[model samples]
Target chain A: MMFLSFVKKEFLHIFRDPRTMLITLGMPVAQIILFGFAITTEVKNVRMAVFDPSHDISTQRIISRMQASEYFDMTQVLHTADDINSAFNKGKAELVAVFSDRFDENLLRAGKASVQLIADATDPNQAAMLTAYASNIIADYRQELLREHRIPFLIEPEIQMLYNPQMKSAYNFVPGVMGLILTLICAMMTSIAIVREKEVGTMEALLVSPLRPVWIILAKVAPYFTLSIVNIISILLLSVFVLDVPVSGSMFWLAVVALMFIIVALLLGIVISSVATTQVTAMLASGMLLMMPVLLLSGMIFPIENMPVILQWISNIIPARWFITAVRKVMIEGLGVSYVAKELAILAGMAVFLIAVSVKTFKIRLS
Target chain B: MKKAIEVENLTKRFGSFTAVNAISFDVAQGEIFGFLGANGAGKTTAMRMLCGLSRPTSGKGAVAGFDMIRQPEEIKRHIGYMSQRFSLYEDLAVWENIRLFAGIYGVPEKEIAPRTDGMLARIGFESGRNTRVKELPLGWKQKLSFAVAIFHEPKIVFLDEPTGGVDPLTRRRFWEMIYDAADRGISVFVTTHYMDEAEYCNRVSIMVDGRIDALDTPKNLKQQFGVRSMDEVFHRLARENALTSNAN
Candidate 1:
């Protein structure tokens, strides 16, 4: 019963501070829209320079085919190799395709043609993607040529992109955004709020009260937990309706995982508050310590498989990584709870461990 | 008269340093007990242990008949603590702060409204009931905090330098509130550096270097020390401690 009053006071504190209210309520929508549209890994409308000396039907066909695809925008037609270098230097094109003079003859006589593709390797990921797209276009052109000539001596590898067939980057980001934002808002806000009491000396009054130390920590976190749930619903809604991100799995399982993750975040916040004596220190600890790891190691923006072996090992310990994987499995893979059981168990274990440590630390600090 | 608080050989040590070293004292049920000490004289530490906020390293103490070590929770229920810092929610309105403490202290829902209104009127802040605590003047905040501390009417209210930086007039007024609370059968265990305020207490203990060097009525302490004022009494005791430590 006393706990309920503490929760009420916490809510009043949140609602009265417009800055905190704005960050808690407004951040998720803004972040979802920002991540969905502005921040994307999928390359689109990539500018390319084509140097086709032959100007033959085959070369024209390939260039036109490349232009036809949504991925490439043929920005310049280079007359010489010098133009290719200048086009790259001036940032006029990300990819340059050069064909030899006898390209059409070689295709007709030898059933294959050499196309040299040069890409600026400044951003290795984007460069690799652009090169892959060019190669795919050339391969498609080769298949069309063979089909038209009635030739059947080619190996065609059929590719299928499972789970996310359209390859929408938004599908990947929505779940990550859910993990990052929830962890950020829940962990950072709870820690700062608790430390604010300590900074202002009200925590002493609270400690001297009849409320148990654990109950006081719970009351401090209860409001943030509610706000996080609201954030989850809003983020999920935005992902589904606005960004067209699908929730193929059961909403019940998703909510279960989300609640577990939120608890873990809140426990982390409690641990932080126990160590931090000031609001600024709490903010710095949560923002720097939690946000950076969640963003980089959780596979939020970068794929975990692509990280170094040691980094991958480190990422395994990040709670958000498990949560993001679980969310992806549920939201995109349409998998049942059985598919995400390991992730769920790990998250639950982390929640228990963090809660235990935080409670112990808080008790020590209070005494 | 019954004892509101009892302490014997209360010693709190932080590793090698003794913060409150084996201090012993008692307060009558309605007495205003002034606890005075130098900056690092362990007054806050002893008060913290008595309030059940901190455990005594080794001692026996009780507040309102509850053991300090074994029944700290019971001690919490029957005592109020006001720290040197104005420890109230600055963002909350005056009445909301009262209601929050009332609720935490388990004041019934039915009594919260009347009690809150009464507290506001008593503090002469009925007009500012809706004003945020941060907007109130420092003196008013201190007064409101004191009023809230005693709102639950605990057997004992511990004030830890409740008038640290307030003006002399305001501090005097605050002492009046303390006297009023004490007169209502609530023992006031107050710690202060203000020697003049120490004179108002029924009895005062002057602590130097974690030990109480003197404990008596203000008039008696003055006569015993052959001093004209409590300030002189306090200065003589503190200077003697400094001189002894230097000799060591």
Candidate 2:
């Protein structure tokens, strides 16, 4: 009864403002479209500078084939191997293809040839994609040789996903996008809403009313919890329909676990609102502070195994990491609910701990 | 008259400093009790303790027949509070703000609309119930805030500087509303830094350095202090306290 009015008032706050509506509903789609399309995980249109010493038929054919495909553009033709550094430094090319002096002769006589791909590894993901594209193109040339001249010297291993067997970039990152968007929207929005009441002095008014402090905090978070669930549903729809990333696992488990993570995020917002006296403080506390760790340490973009051992250990405490991990298992790997039990346990533990901390602080604030 | 509030040795200490130091007072039902103080004289602190917004460091008090310490939540059900800062959601319409506060106070769902309309009618604010609170003038906002505070008809209502930053004419009108609430047997415990407003109360208590320096009717206080007005009475009390502190 009283709780319903509090929840209704919270909804009124969100709906009466246009910007809040956009941020709560539109942010997920915009971020997903931007990440899905603009930040491409699969490399294409990569500019390449060649350092071909013995410009033989095989070398010419391989370069032309790579250029003919949509993946690579042979941008600069270099005179010597010494030009590789300058070509990379000039930034005209993301990668330089350097072939050994006797490229075709070694292939014909010794069944061996070397083509070194040097790429800018500053963005490790793009660098890896560039090298992968280059090797795949070279292996294609090797395939043609075996079919035409009966020579076989290469083996190509394909990258595949169970749902998206062709390994679409969207398939790889949809879970990650879900992790980033839900954590930020749920935590930041909930905190700002609660802190706004404090800033406006209505919180003190509500506190002095017959309503319990626990009910007040719950009312503040309830609307955002509902909104975040809306966000999760829309994100899943966009992943499946727009981005072509299928959820191969049971939908029930996926929704259940996502709701659990939202609880953690919302509770985090409550704790933040308890410490913050102003809306701006709450925003910075939940928005920028939560973002860096969520984006970097959550294993959303960077793999946890590739990180330093200390960083890997540190990532364990970040709630988003467990969420993204569980999402990948359920959405991409087609795993069962039992597979995410450990992740579910961690998130539930976080929710309970935050609940206890918020309750303690709430009682302290009352006194 | 029955006592609406009673307190003895109500002290609130923030570490080494006591904000409200062993203050004691009471308000009879239907009385307009004024709490006057200088800046940081701890009037707000004592009011918060009575309203169940804060726990006293040590002491005892009862608000609306409930123990302030052991039954803070119970005390909340029987009292209304208006903060020093304007307490309505500025973005909400007048009726919406009324509904929200009334509903939170646990007014029956069916009674909210009629009571809202009745209060608006009595205030003679017709046809602007849909106006957002921010769009309303400061004077009207203050009136609406008072109306909402007592809308649930709590036995006692605490007003913390309810008329700061309003004009004299508008302040008079606002006090008329307060007088009407008190006439309905609602105890009004109000605090103000403005000495002139203290004259409007049935009984005024001047707080100086966390203590009630004087408690009496306006006429009695002036007669006792050999002063002409509540303003002079307040100045003499504060100035004497300043002189004592300087000597110490």
Candidate 3:
């Protein structure tokens, strides 16, 4: 009963402040949309080539669709698999869309088909965006095929983004955005909300009450926890609908894993609030101590593998690194729960360790 | 009268510094017990020990019959507290603040609304129940906080320097509220450096350099110190420590 009051009070604190409400809800939508469109390497009217050996109706339809889209203008038709490499080497075409043999026959017979997109990856950003657009077109075509026919037609665009790949931006950013926003909202906001009470001296009145310290911390966490879940849902929705990122894996497992990530971030917040006496200190600590690591080291911006060996080792310990990896597997790679078991275990361990640390460190008495 | 508090040899110390040293006292039911000291005179440290906020280094204490050390949580449930600084939610309306604290203090849900009305009426703040606490005058804010503190009817309430910077008028009005709470049989454990406020307490314990050097009613303390007022009594006690520290 007392716990309910504490939760209600925290909710009031969040609701009463308009700035907090805006930052909590408005910031994520703006960021994902901005990153999806504004800070993009998206280029238009790219020269393209097709290696459609089958030249069947399915292949012709996809080729015409690719040409009709605003992003691609087909300039050549290659006849050999070997021509894909030379076409890029000779600056003949920026991309090569290679359809499999007997494309329409195989697609109708097996309800599955493949289209290999190869791109000039000398500029990884341009390469990422080109593939993202190309793949989005294919995904839309595949959706049309599913609507027209009853079979589960899997038109898997084989993304050798190592060479060329749509939502390559999606694959990279949707998870990155989730990691960044969750950290900002859960870790930073939770700590600030808690430290604000301490700064106002209300904590003394609270500590003296029958409400247990854990209950107080939980109540503080509860609101942000709910907010972050909302953020997660919205970001995922935006990714699927606006950004065209696929929820290839199980949606239920994706949500479950994301919820675990939220817990880890929220626990980090509790740990930070345990140490920070004021809101400024909490925010700076969260920024310096949590955000920097999440941004630079979580493979959110820079790939962890390409980082220096020591930095790679350090990145392994950053919670977002694990969260992004888990999300990528569950969301983009279309993997199952068992695939992300290690990441989930590590996140669960972090949650437990943080809970223990917060318990030990949270002050019961004022200095 | 039943005892609201009992303690013996309460001492709290840092590594090499003793902030509260072997101090002990008792408060009868419904009495206003003033914990008197200058700034940094160990009064807060001692009170924190009794309130179960700070663990005593070595002491025995009980708040409202609950053992302070072993059952601090139980003691917390039975006692009320107001911090040295203003502690109400500035953004929340007065009625919201009341409902929040009342609920947190485990006031029966059924009694909360009616009691909240009663509290607002008693504090003469019925019309402004919807006023955000930050907009209220600081003095009235303090009064509202005090009313809320005792709203759950805890056996004892520990207030730490509640009137630190209030004007004389507000301080007097604050004291009137304290007297009113005392009449209804709630023990008030208040800490203050104000010598004049000491005169209003049923009993006052004056601490100098971490020890309670004088514990008596204001009239008796004035008589024992051969002084005319509680201010003179305090100076007489603090002056000796001042001289000794200066000599060292």
Candidate 4:
């Protein structure tokens, strides 16, 4: 009953504060909308510089094909070798495709032609995606040419988009946004909330009460847990109804996993608050320590698989990694609850461990 | 009379710095004990140890009939704490803050609503019970904080410089509230640098350089130190120490 009242009070606090409400719900939707409309994880509108020295119908046809495709945006037509570096350096071109001289003549004689692809590897991930799109377009063109020439016995590997055939940024980001926003609002915010009490000296009043330390922590974390879950559902609903991002896995399992991770985040907030003497320290520490990891390591912005081996291992331990994986499996792949059982268990374990440690630290500090 | 709080050779050291040197004191139940010290004289540290917020590095203490080290949790339940800093929730209304403290103290839910209203009314803040604590004047906030501290009717209430920034009239009103609680058989253990406030205590103890330099009724202390008033006594002792240090 004592713990319940504290929890009630916590809810009151969260509900009363508009700033907290904005961070939890408004920010997630805002981020999802921004990332969905403004950014493309699949790499579209790539600026390309074409150098077609062949001056033949086939070269022009290829350039037309490239321009017509949504993947490539023809920004420049370079005539000289010196122009290549300047085009790339000016950021006007991501890919420089050179059609060698006599390229159309060779296609008619030996029925073979080569195109040189020089890509800016500065943003390797973008470069890689752009390269894949270019390769597919070239492959399609080659197939058309072979069919026109009455070629036979040709083998081509069929490309299959295993998941997210539409490849919308919303599908890729909604789940990650949910995880990041929930952690920031639930864990980071709640941790600082308690420290605020301490700073204002209200903690002494609470401590003098018969309210147990564990109960106080529970009260502080409980409201955030509820608020974050509400945020999760709202985001999920928006993703499905508004954005048309499909849930590939069990919605029930997805919710369960999400809740598990949220609990872990809330517990982490409690631990942070227990250690921090002031609200400023709590906010600073949680923001720097939790937000960055959730943003980078959770595979929200960057692919975890392509990261260096050490960073890969580091990301493995991050709670956001499991959450992102679980959310993606459910939201993108529509995987069942059974499929994400391991991740859910890991999240639950982390939550329990963090809560236990927080309780212990609180007791030690109080004593 | 039962001893509400007792400290024997209590010492608290942080790293190499002795915040509270070996000190011993006792307060009977229902007494108003004023703790006086210059800044950094370990008054807060000693009060913390007695309140069980901090542990004594050496020696022993009991607070509210429980061993400070062995049963701090029990002691915590039986005592209330208010710091020089206003301790109520700024965003919460006066009544809400009272109810929160009451709820934390495990006041029966059925009793919380009435108790909250009663506390507000008793503090003459019933009209502004719904007003946010931050919206209230400093004097009212201090009064609300004091009322919230003893919401559970704890055996002892600890106040660390509870009236630091208030005017004399407001401080006097705050003292009246303290006396009211003491009149109800609640022991008041308070720390302050205010010499005028020190004079109102049934007994006062002054701390200097981590040790108690004087302990007695304010009149006795003034007379023994050969000073005109409590303030002069404190200044004389502190100045004498400075002169001795310079000579050394």
Candidate 5:
């Protein structure tokens, strides 16, 4: 009964305070839309230069096709292939496409043409994508030309997309959004609540109560756990209905894993509250301490494999990385529990360690 | 009558600063015992030690029939505390605050409702049970805070300047509530700088320079200091201490 009343009171506070409402709900929506549209791994609208040495009908048609594609915006039609290096050096173009000399002679004689694509490889992923898109356009043009003359190739490479076959950005983002939202709700909110109690001087009342420090800490965090679960359900509903994001695994399993993550987050929040003296300090600490790790290292934005070795090692310690991995396996890949046992066990161990640390810190502070 | 609280040479130090220097006192059940001192005279530190919020550097003590140092949790279960500031949740309604406190104290659900209703009526706050604590006047909030502090019927209630900033009329009404609690055999360990309020206590102790200089009934303190009131007695003792310091 006491626990229920405490939970009810916490909910009342969350409802009454406009700041809490804004941070919990408004910020989640804003971040989702921001990351969905603006902050993305896939680069777009790359500038390019076309060095068409052939100057023939087929070469011009391919150039036109590349321009029509949304991925590339051809801002310049170069006069010389030598200008490619200068254009890229001056940051005018990220990619340059060149066709061999002989105009239409080679294509007419051998029924084949060679094109060289040059890209600024500073950002390797962007360069790779640009190269792939340019090549695909050339391939399409070649296939069309051959079909016009009824020519057929003896050998062809059949294309297949193994993972993320649909290539829908939403499918990639659902797991990320789950990690960010759950961590913020369970960790940041609880820290703020604990610091607020200390600020208002009511913590002294609880400290003086017959309630043990461990019980008090548990009671303080219990409400946020409940709310975070509710938020998880809300996000799931929004993902399925609004975003049309699919969950391939068991919903029950997903919920169980998410609850375990929430528990870990709550313990982390308690540890933060123990070190912070005020609400502002706690909020800043949680944001810098937890949010940054989740954002950068959780495989939500950056690919951990492509990162520097040092950074990859750094990412290994971030709890959100493991949770996001688990979630994606269950949701996107539809992997079973047996397949994700290692990640789940690591998360469970992390939760236990965090709870133990929080308990020790709470007891020390009480003493 | 059993002693509700007892302390012998109870001391508390904060690093190099001696906040409470070997303070000693006793409170009988159903008695109003006041610890009187000027600001920073260590009244709070001593009271916190008795309330089991702060540890004493040295000495032994017992509160509410339990050892204060070895078994703080037990002492907590048997006592209530209302800090100098109004510590109740400002966003919570009067009845909700009552319910929350009662709940935290582990009051059974079936009895909480009636007890809360009865408490609100007894405090003459039945009409405003739904009002948020922040919206109420300072006096009303102080009264409400006091009622919440003792709602669990702990063996002893600690009021650390509970009447600060309250008007005289409200302070009197608050004392009436305190007196009623005391009459029910609940000891009151109150600390206040209000010289007028000191007269209401069954026994009063005045501290100077982190040490209790005098402890006695109000009449005895007045007679021993050859003063007409507790204020004059306090003034005389403080003036004497200042003179001794100057001589040193």
Candidate 6:
């Protein structure tokens, strides 16, 4: 009964502060929409400079083909090789497609053509992706030409992009956003809430009360738990309805995994609050320690396999890595619980370990 | 007379230094016991031990018939604590704050409504019951914190410099509330750095360098120290400790 009132007070604290309410409920929606539409991995409308020295039917045909594709915005046509350097340097183009000065007579006699793609590799990931996209478009055009001219020596490889046929970044980001948002709201908010009580001196009153210290922690965490659930639902709704990300597996399993991750995050928050003496320390610890790991090392924005070996080893310990993997398996791949059993078990173990450590630390600090 | 608080050589040490050194005292039921000391004099440390918030390194104490160490939870149930920093949720409405304490202290559901209404009327701010605590003046917040601390009607209430930073009039009104609680047989264990406030207690103890140098009625302590007021009594006792330490 006392615990119930404490929970009610927690709710009152959350509702009375409009800023906390806005962050808890509104942040996830904003982040999902922002990341879905604005921050995308799929390259679109990439400005290209075409150095078509040949100026023949074949080069014009290839330039028109690149223009027709959504990926390349073929706006600049360079006359000299010197223009390639200036065009790239002036930021007028990200890619310069240089075609050799060859007449149609050479292609007809030798049945061969050479094209060079020069891309600015400042952002290596985007540079690699843009070059691959341009090459793929050129390869498509070659296949069509070969089919028309009955040149049977070239072997064409049929590539199928399974799971995400159109390769929508939303498919990848929605689950990652769900993981990131849940961990942030659950861990950061709960730690800040508890630390605020300590800063305001109400924690001393709470400790003096008949309410058990563990119950005090639970009371502090109860509201954020509910808010995190609401956040999960909001993210899911926004991803599914607005972003058009599909949920192929059972919603029940997805919720179960999400709940486990939320519990893990809340336990982490408790551990942070137990160590932090002030609200600023708690906020910094949560933001710097927890948020950075979840964002960078958890395979949220970057793939874990492609990272350095040491970093990949470090990513294994981040709870969000396991969570994002499980969520993608369940939500995007439409896999069942059996497929993600290892991840679920790891998350459950982490939650238990964090809870035990936090409880021990809290008790030591209280007395 | 029944004793409300009994401390026998209660000591607390942090590593090599003693914060509270062999402090012993007692207060009778319904008595206002003033715990007075300068900054870092260990008064708060001793009060914390009696309030069951800290463990004493040596000796024993009891509050409201519960052993400080073994029955800390029972002692917590029977005592209330208010710090100089007002311990109310500023975001909560007045009535909500009151109800929260009442509920946490296990006040029965049947009596909570009447008790809350009575408290609002006593504070004479029935209109402000719905106002957020942060919106109220600091004086009002301190008073409300005291009221909430004792809302469960604990047998003893502990106030650690509860009147610090308040105006003289507000402190006077706060003492009136303290007197009212004592008159109703609630033992008040209050700590204050203000010597003038010490004169209002039924009995006062002055601590110097973690030791209680004097424990007597304010009038008797003044006479014992050959002083006219509690201020002189405190200064003489503190100076004696300084002279002794200098001699050592």
Can you give the DockQ of every candidate in the order shown?
Answer: 0.79, 0.78, 0.49, 0.58, 0.62, 0.83
**Residues B112-169, candidate 4, lDDT per residue (tens digit)?**
8888778777877779978988898898888888898898899889988899898999
| CA lDDT, every model vs. true structure | 0.86, 0.85, 0.87, 0.80, 0.82, 0.85
Tens-digit lDDT string for candidate 6 (A1-66) = 789999999998888789888888888988898877665467899999888778888778778888
Quote each prediction's TM-score.
0.87, 0.89, 0.81, 0.83, 0.84, 0.87
Ranking of candidates on TM-score, top first: 2, 1, 6, 5, 4, 3
Q: Across residues A1-367, which tens digit of lDDT does each residue of candidate 1 receive?
A: 6888789999999999999989999989988988676744789999988998989998898899999999999999999979988998789988888887778887787665678878765444466678788889888877787789875323232322222233435477788889988887889999999999989999989999999988898898888998999999998889889988778999999999999999899889989989998999999999888889888888777777767899999998888999999999999889999999999999999988997898789678766
Off by over 4 Å in 6: A39-168
Local error of candidate 3 at residue B204 (angstroms): 1.2
Off by over 4 Å in 5: A18-46, A51-57, A64-72, A76-91, A94-106, A114-169, A249-253, A308-310, A336-342, B13-19, B38-40, B55-58, B226-248
RMSD to the hidden true structure, all candidates: 4.7, 4.0, 8.6, 5.0, 4.6, 4.7
- Backbone clash pairs for candidate 4 read A210-B105, A248-A333, A248-A334, A248-A335, A249-A330, A249-A334, A249-A335
Of 2 and 3, the candidate ahead on TM-score is: 2
Q: Pick the winner on lDDT between candidates 1 and 3.
A: 3
Per-residue lDDT of model 3, residues B1-248, tens digit only: 67899999989999899999898899988999999888888887887778777889998988998998899888888898997677689999998998898888888999999998888888888999899999998898899989988999999999888898888889999999999999999999998878789989999998898999999999999999898999999999889889999999
Give the candidate number with the greatest DockQ: 6
Q: Give a tens-digit lDDT track for model 2, residues B156-235.
A: 99998888898888889999999999999999999987777888999999889999999999999999999898889988
Strongest candidate by lDDT: 3
Best by TM-score: 2
Q: Give lDDT tens digits, candidate 6, residues B12-114.
A: 9999999999888888899999988888999878877887888999999888998987999899899998999878999888888888888889999989999
Rate residue A100 of model 3 by lDDT: 90
* Candidate 1 ranges with C-alpha deviation above 4 Å: A39-57, A60-93, A96-103, A106-168
lDDT of 4 by residue, A167-194 (tens): 3334667878887887798778998888
Q: What CAPRI grade goes to candidate 4? A: medium
- Candidate 3: deviation at residue A222, Å? 0.9
Predicted model 3 interface RMSD? 1.9
What's the TM for chain B in candidate 1?
A: 0.96
